[model samples]
Target: MEKKAAEKRVQELHTLLNQYNYEYHVLDHPSVPDAEYDQLMRELTDIEAQYPDLVSPESPTQRVGGEILSAFNKVEHKIPMLSLGNAFNEADLRDFDRKVKQAVGDDVEYVCELKIDGLAISLHYENGLFIQGSTRGDGTIGEDITANLKTIRSIPLRISQPMTIEVRGEAYMPKKSFEKLNQQKEENGEEPFANPRNAAAGSLRQLDPRIAASRNLDIFLYAIGDFSETGATTHHDGLNLLEKLGFKVNKEREKCTSIEEVIQYVQKWVEKRPHLPYEIDGIVIKVNSFVQQSELGTTAKSPRWAIAYKFPAEEVVTRLRDIELSVGRTGVITPTALLDPVRVAGTKVQRASLHNEDLIREKDIKIGDHVVIKKAGDIIPEVVNVLVERRTGEEKEFLMPTHCPECESELVRLEGEVALRCINPKCPAQIREGLIHFVSRNAMNIDGLGEKVISQLFSHELIHDVADIYRLQKDQLLALERMGEKSVTNLLAAIEKSKSNSLEKLLFGLGIRHVGAKAAKTLAQQFGNMNELKKATREELTAIQDIGEKMADSIVSYFENEEAISLIQELEAAGLNMNYTGPMPVQVESISSSLAGKVVVLTGKLEQLTRNEAKEQLEALGATVTGSVSKKTDLVIAGADAGSKLTKATELGIEVWDEEKMLEEFNR
Candidate 1:
């Protein structure tokens, strides 16, 4: 094709694809079949590849996102993404209504929307092209997640009119997408996400845009950020303008002339909320007029003109028939309340997590007692409170077991932790659970070996430990129930594939005490290999930043075991990887700076960094950052609405700096 022809074709395809994407993803209508869309996308991709310079940033092909990011950069919100004050019950909504009426006069109208339980994000458009997108991090400054946000097809790459705008929206994972994603995770031997909200957040935070693209994330543009340039008079008008500009505006919104109508909308949605494709935690009520919003203004964190009415979490009364105990991979004994099968949060509930023994005693939960049960979406069912008034003399006080239920070993509670644990390394339950963990996603990640299959293998004596996983033969796998020829082949292939995993995966897979995924990665990156890691003393281990005394002790203890050493050798013999293939550990610089060589305690909401991200940046600058306040704390980097740590810092008369100061120092 000629250059002129290719350019015209590329631009045409961009327009066509964007239209189709909006129709399918936003409007739930597609004029073209998926195959037809794919063909056009393929044509566009080819044309763009042939004429790279002709491809614009707003091209539909750009939705796949660019190259992988090293780390997310902080972006300052031009207009702050203020949160909404919450209303839990009818009274709270009425109070909010009365307050709004007082402030904006009796002629106020409100817009009610389903408050989607997802991450809040800001999308910036320049000349109608989507230029940037960021998270609602601390309501002021947020992480630049442009690449991830671009992958959400529902977000228009370019609007109809050439206009500059910043829009606020909820980026969410649909219920179907969430379920599919979790199923995929389980199938891949990975941990499933807790809910749609978490799945969406996790998806959009991926360093690789390809990961986010695969997640099928969608967004609902609710409010216009700094709509001064736009001729939108009301919140409802802004939403319409957004939709007209090809953005996915949720249709499940209503304009109410009175607070009574708002209350009715909230109540109606309280019943209708569960049926939506995405989770809605609450109904958001906002004074319709932008003038009224400006009049009411905002607090430091939230807008006074708006209030979100959260549905009281669904609670039901159920009989706690008995208490059950189970041992985990780490040998921790966890208690569960086996209840009379009852429905909570749309799912049948048979068991509720009792947490540890301390919780049971604290709650004074008794067997055969009627207990209030509650669950919010995919969250685990919990005992809200025991119905003490309904309890009869037949109710028996539940006691925690002194011994491991599976191994019959005497359980001991570790210092600082609440649960009783079996410290015996050879306990069958621990071994089984550890084996499962070894094949888990953050570890070696051997697929096709789910809980049922792992349990079958263990019970049949085909595997005793993580090392035995490599020794399993096809015949042994074939002997298990439901093990077909293809499944056996896939399982064997997956096991073989896990051998190439990095040293960090192996370290985490070992299930070392007090050594979590992050610590394992740290240790692997520090030592670089199994041999070097095993040689490290507790002192040497503790010398590394974030490698606390407990973690160091655990690492040394794990390495000191003869069986552990033998297992490493066996893994080596089976051709499992031992060297860390990930990035080397970052060395703390000795150069002088405001934060250098200082003991810092970070508190409250950080605008620019996640807690780990902050710790990493500070550590890189040679700061010994700790979690809590103490006499040794040199500086406290207090953020917006800082809590007890900030108070403790004030009490200690420690020098304090806000996020701005911290960022300045970080930049320096």
Candidate 2:
């Protein structure tokens, strides 16, 4: 029980447990029995408790998770996590191959890896010790999930070589783990996860790392963020190096000398996918040589040297038992097809979106009709078609309802729109949906105010509007079905915290007709304050790029409404912050007019500034930042590894500027 003896024992336990963990979780071969491993872990935990100073983050006991996180902090990826282009057919693969060969020559080799159907993650190591891990948020930025990621036993706390590195991978839940977890969920009267991918994602995103640790997640470290540190010549070499460093590299990867061989690998996996212990949606084909990859370069979004060959969607037929209608926040009535329960794309599907009345009518969907369904992009189930031959004579033709299903208001199809809409401002369904949107993650982000709680509050008449949420009493919440003292306290604290959010969150939470998160940010930056925004005319609003005439009209009309003005005053009275808290907008007169009125697009990674900073700078200099390149694009700021946008810019004969040129222009 002495400090010296405890320290030595802790170190020994670390070595033994880490090795055993690697053997069991990564290598799938346990040299020791489960009881033995557990006993050692318990000893380590007890020793650490006895000599608290001897405990370290690298200890095996730390894998069980520590404290709960209040919020996930934003992490900027030093190397951008660029997405791969996808190929759905043999022709697409051949096309990708031809392009790769054309750019890097036919002497190229390709490494084929299984495209894991899970969450993408980046792991950062400093001198071989796992420092941080994050989700692939918007490529350049991600949410810090180090605590959650540490729970995955396959992920080593320390690498072998004691070198700094950033590696990328896919974190997943195995089929067995997913089944067991879902079974537990069902037994507990909780909704089971739709698929392993969803379950994995949900586990990793949990505010409590203990929840993630319980999920039994796994990972496969595939690509190194930078291979220069290890002197790896090829993608295959990098994978081998990762494996040597105590990382779980997928052993199913193959090195193909030709595109034909790559095609065979893809085809082989397509047939063998169902048998794998974990789910794989596709095969990722990458040019093997690092030199060739550099030669080929990337487009705006994806790499030219790599493509993911997505498996064909699984299709199944189910009976459309009934048509269900729901009212959206915008009062648009959406039709959903309630079908007989069936499994497709590794998930149970009992409902598919019918989109709108036009889609329903065009497909001629009827009650009790057998319909073919498939997952679009392996997520949303949709009605591919109807099997007319299998339709029973008793099938009833469906029609769009003439009234709002919730509020009993008459529905009308607005001009230039195909769907029926309920214009009733006070409709209970719209109010409920709007409240849900207002408290969403991208909006006010009140932590414990979930959809279920919101629905309960609405039904109980404890909250009628978003502002009413702030006025909620603790006693009122405590009286609700599931709201415990702790739950009510946390909910109230979260609601209080949201009142201090920047103007963009408030603007997005308002649910303006045509304004999205991006547009909301833009507006917040431009106007600086809610008072200025309220005074903006249609002409002034449209002058800002990305704001169209329709959007401008919507904004102007929204501000003119007395009810909206009253609601804004109410929110302001509730101690909500009204000023923009982000970077200040550049003054028009201070910057050069050279880029004035030009449609500009930024691509790839910039060394000096983030994509957003560069975008704001460009916009301040009178350049309009757009996502895509077209003939209308006046200029393109191409950065490191610039992808398809750069190619398209060249193809269209548009002006292209490198980072240096852009910086020089900004200086001028």
Q: TM-score winner among the candidates? A: 2
Pairs of residues clashing in candidate 1: none
Can you write out model 2's per-residue Cα lDDT over 1-668, one digit (the tens) per residue? 77888888888999999999999999999999999999999998899888888878788888766689999999998877877776889999999988888887779888999999889999999988998999986566789999999999999999898899999999999988998998776543245777798899889999999999999999999999999878899999999999999999999999999888998898888888878889988899999999999998986666898998878788998999999999999999999999999978776788999989899889888999999998865667899999999876999988888999999999999999988999999999999999999998788888778777888899999899999998999999899886789978988998999999999999999999989877898999999999999999999999987888998999999999999999999999999999999877565567567987788999865634457767876887877787789888999998755768899999999999976567656645
- Which 10 successive residues of model 1 have the least lDDT summed? 583-592
TM-scores of the candidates are 0.72, 0.77
Model 2 spans > 4 angstroms off: 30-36, 63-86, 92-111, 119-128, 131-148, 160-168, 173-216, 223-245, 255-261, 275-277, 286-307, 531-562, 586-668
Task: Compute the lDDT for candidate 2.
Answer: 0.88
